[model samples]
Target: MMRALRALVRKDLTLFFEDRRAVVLSFAAPIAIGAFFGFLFSGGGGGNAKIPVRVADLDGSSVSRAIVAALEKDKALEVKSATSADEARELVRRGKATAAVILPKSFGEEAVNAFFRQTDKPDLLLLRDPSHTAEAGMLRGILTQHVMEVVSKEAFSGPAGLRSARQALRQVSEDKAMAPSDRKDLTVLLQSVVNLQEHSTSEKTEALGPQGGIGVPYDTKEEEVTAHAGETYNGYAHSFGGMALQFILMASIEFGMGILIERRTGIWKRLLAAPLHRSTLLLARGISGALISLAIFLVCMGFGMAVFGVRVQGSWPGFLLLAVAYALMASAFGLLLAALGRTPEATRGLAVFAVLILVMLGGAWVPAFIFPAWLQKATLLLPTRWAMDALDGVTWRGLGLASALPAVAILLGFTFVFALIAAWKFPSEEG
Candidate 1:
């Protein structure tokens, strides 16, 4: 049985290697796809890294300059200075920039006066498309922070702090502690000075409830530095590499059914007459199927490295072990399919639907984290999940062999179970 399996596997390997298109589709296609998408994602889809933002300031004041400076502080944002509102809008519409900021002419003056009068706050106009939500939201945050800071500075320095000082002095004068008019005046004057010092330098003072106390300005230097540290690899390539490894495993179905075909064509009968046991023939085909899978896996990985800048930070031995285990499992599944289906049409149609569904649910198209709770739990029973998890461990998670042990073990278990099932229903000859 073992000898016959070896012979069958050897023959399959020979056929696969010799057929140029088979070699290309099984191996080259996945690698090419992995490389292309990897490059796209690693390079940020080849779009502009800096978010182009247009700024139109009718205020033409220092306040506008300060706001622009604050926006520029965020590395993700790029301020394109515009002289008019029309130009800014045109820039946005033409896709030259993401969004535009339009400051009203009386923005600063109204904000300052509003603070003095304790009235409504000034408003800054934001012009943007609905499609640019993230960039617009971020630009709005920076601008709002700047506006609040400006308003706070003006309020504390100009009149708000002054009013609080005088009110406190008036309370002290009315305390009537056996004081003459002239003496009360002196006390009020002294109290006013102390109040000014306390309000103006609020860090040394305690909170004054809902009225809000004056405070030193907050430092946003660290926030600006960490928000965008350096370059980022693309998501497109990473996803492509993972999907390629996952979907290519489906080739096992073809190889398995090819065995049944050879039997129908009398090839298997001739091979069986060559002093090869039936079990040996099956084992050889399994080994050959695994080799083809591993070959495809390696080529895809190589493409990722050469084109997409993906680095596998895990143990190479561990990765190879997982890959071989997954291949074996995929081969076993194909054999199972062949054992179940009595004919070629049945195998092809059923295998395609079943394999595609498993791959889709197994995080081949989307990450499993986004799946529902019950679906996530169900994935533990699926070999594709283990395969994807193992690959992710090597590529993204920086995990070694130890981390991939669960996945490898599960794949091996599946392979064993599948091969056993196939053996139970093993066909004596193709019908």
Candidate 2:
């Protein structure tokens, strides 16, 4: 019995190895996907990998320049320059830059004023992408820290510091936000500093802005902008689309299996021998497959909306257009599978493995934004990627009908390619 079991195991292994496509895809899927997931989960961005940001220095003063330089020196950030705040905003919108920091005109003067008075904050604007909110939070801290460090040193020792301190002393008593005791304390400190400067011009002291290290010297007004109709981003709205895609494609694979079974069982020979043209038969099958896949997607979406708070935040018509286009693409993909496959028995493992890899590359398992720029760009050629992007844009992104059209067009283009190849390869004559 042991010898027989060993022989059986060897036979199964040999059979599995005989199908080269199955072996390659079966093993390749895990390795390729695992590497990406490992990199993402391990906090594995190296020195070269840094968050990209745009800096707009409208002030162009020595102080503003120093702040920009400090941000450039930070290892965690990848900085680029924009000539204007409008240009910086365009960068964030285009996805060329992840975030933007705008230093308005006279920001340098206000920053110096802020160093002495806790209430006086320099005007700063931060335009951020909603998708990169977590990164934005970290970036906000980095920006605040660098601005304070650079501006504080400037406000402490320079001739301007004495002038600003004296100016602040006059305003302290009139400031309504300050408590009476706090106002008096600030008044005496400023008075002493002005007196010391006048009496001992040669004496100098190194100071890091406020004595107790006050909060950020700049007041930032942050705005989240993207091509969305919704005010906020909903993660599940896009995630459910990913899940629905997987389910729809799985159904398509089954459709291919059905075609293979019919071909193997002499159904094709009988059907072709009749007056019916092969193209008509193929078209009917695709239509049925498309309808089935669409049903599956709708059911999945229904559940997602009921349970997960997923939404059609964008135009309803646009969302439906994406879904229909994806369904047609899936049907064409099914036809391609049937044409490539020798038999249902031979194709099942390979087809399933291929689907998984496609889904992974499509960013169903992991978000594509986490991918390096090049990989994200490369994945755009894929129909799955196009579908996923449309899903994101129309759902969480709140994009309009116009935005969805391009992805729909791409999906139809892919469908045409898949159908053309399937028609060329599909066997009409019985073996």
Candidate 3:
């Protein structure tokens, strides 16, 4: 029985390889698609693409100039100076810029006073293109960070910082040894510090909601933890992972169609007339399909690494385990389709449609993060999601073997279930 199964598997493999078009389509198509997406997302070379921002500085004050200078310094922004707010707005409306920042008259004075907590915050107008909301949001965040930096430097500097300055000024105001004029000045300074502190506290409270949090309110620091030193994020890693999974499904469908073709041509009947057992025949087909899928996956990923810089940053062993498990699952799925499908043409069409739906819901074309929260939760039931996640974990996420085990386990479970269904429904010689 083992010899018969091995011979059947070898025959299938030989037939698959003889079709050069099939081999090329299974391997090359995925790599090509993945490279296109990688280049699109990473700007071809993984450099940051700057968002164009038009600034209309009507105030011409030192503060406004300083703000413009800060904007220019940001790597993410391409700052353009405009003579008037109208001009800046026109630029945004015409899609030349993402947003228009207008610094109104007296902005410098109002902004400084606001920083000292002695006046209302300046109402700078931010006119943004409706179509570029993401860019506008990013610009807003950058503007907020710049303002916070300026305020923190001015209000909390020198020997008289936020806490110490308020304390020192209060002590001077209460001292009878000081002149009335000096005491009055000290009192005013103390009030400014007190007001700023109170405002800051109130803002923090509002941001934290009713329940206070343990972490810092304003997160200015960012730290990247990588599995390997000097290793950076590769956009191709995600693109390739998704593309490979999608194309593997297509390959699986083709594998199913092969079975359908054999059945239509009476090849199954011829094989049954031989010494081969039904169970052995089914196992042979499953093994052949699994081997083909595994080879295609490895070739696609290899191309990704060599051409697009994708890497298995975590455990290579774990990554290999995931690849094998997913390939087996895909093979079993193909066999199940073969068992359930009625005719060759109909089976091919239905299998393709089902594969497309699986890919769409699996987050193979887009990041799962973009999905609605509920939909994201629901996608957890999909085998493709587990496969994609496992690939991501071992590649860009830099997760270890331990982290990939659950996904591998889930894929193997799916394989077992699919194989059982295929076995139960497999066409017999008697039928």
Candidate 4:
């Protein structure tokens, strides 16, 4: 068995070296993809840099002034003011602002009304580009968190203040609804006051400008909240490596198709007529395909590390064990593909499509966490997703062997199942 395996392995290596296409597919493609995507993911689209936030407060009223003050306080953000919502939107469109916050007139009144009525709505309009999801979400998170606290407080306490105001409306119009413009204006006024109140109490606090609109109540304390350094690593290395592993496995068709051609040309029958056992033949093919998968996997990882500075910080032994397990699963999957695809055309078409679909759903195309809750749960069944998660745990999170054990176990199970199916389906020469 050892001699047969060595001979088969040597033959595979020789044939693979002689074929430039095979060499390119197995080695060159991985390195190229790693470098290209490494740059792409690390470029402007990634969350590596801070984006500016523009503020436009039209109300100029005391409330708008306070909210503007709060805007100037966030350190993660750089604030600029625009004259109107249209101006703010244009700045966002021109990439001058990652996002813009507009405080319409009457913002304070709505806040005052909502506060008195115990309602929690504050009307601050956000203008942002749809393409910048991460930046938009981040800005939303920071602004919303601070704004809501101030707005909600008004919800609880502002009604009492409104009641105490000495000036009463000359007439209350009953039949007509409040204009949208008037409602927006009211909300802005209340929020500005709320913004002013919150920042005034903090360590870096400043008093609100008395009815005289000074620039928004600015605070220096918020600067401390945003001062972390270094490039952001969004855990893309493991994901890229996992994808490389999954696709390299598809190259098993190089061997799988080779098997069929050999059979048609009487190579298998001739080998069967000799002393070789079926187990030896099958094991040789599996090992050869697995070695190819491993080589491609390693090349991608090395390129990623050398070029992109990504490293596997976890246990080396644990990573190797997982790699080996994943390779076996990949090899088995290839054999399964060969067994199912009786013709080269069918194998190429069906295998490519199937692998693509699997990769897409497995979170190779997008992180599994981004999927809907149900889709995330569904991804558990895919071998690629598990491989991605395991690699992420090892390389990105530096997880220990104990934590990666479940992924290893599941991958090995998949290998066993695929191998068994291949063994059952793979035809012996005479039979």
Error of 4 at 8 (Å): 40
Q: Which number leads on TM-score?
A: 2
Model 2: CA > 4 A from native: 1-25, 36-97, 102-107, 122-125, 157-162, 165-214, 219-230
Per-residue lDDT tens digits for candidate 4, residues 1-431, read 99999999999888767755445545544565566446445542233334577887877755567667776887667788899877776555433466788776766655544433334334577766443457677877777555544444333233322331211111112213667676565456645554555445453433432233212222111110100112234344655676686677577666677776666677878877889887778778889888888887887887888887767766667678778888888888877776665655446555655576567667567533234444555778988777776676566445568656778899899988988888888876454
lDDT of model 1 at position 399: 57
How do the candidates rank by TM-score, highest first? 2, 3, 4, 1
Q: Is candidate 1 or candidate 2 better by TM-score?
A: 2
Per-residue lDDT tens digits for candidate 3, residues 345-415, read 56666677678767876868764433444555678888998888778778865777977898899999999
Candidate 1: regions farther than 4 A off: 1-237, 429-431
Alpha-carbon TM-score of each model against the true structure: 0.49, 0.76, 0.55, 0.53
Worst 10 residues of 3 by lDDT: 208-217
**Which regions of candidate 3 deviate over 4 angstroms?**
1-219, 223-225
- Model 4: lDDT equals 0.61
Question: What lDDT would each prediction earn against the true structure?
Answer: 0.63, 0.80, 0.71, 0.61
Candidate 2, residues 1-431, lDDT tens digits: the string is 99999999999999988888677767776787688668755655431246789999999988899899999999888899999988887667545577999999989878888877766687799988776777798899998788877766665555666688788888886789989999988898888766755544465555335343345667898877555422665667667898899878898999999999988788887888889899999999999999998898888888878998778877789889888999999999999999989867557777777788778778787655566656666788888888887787777666679878998999999889999999999986776
lDDT-superior candidate, 2 or 3: 2
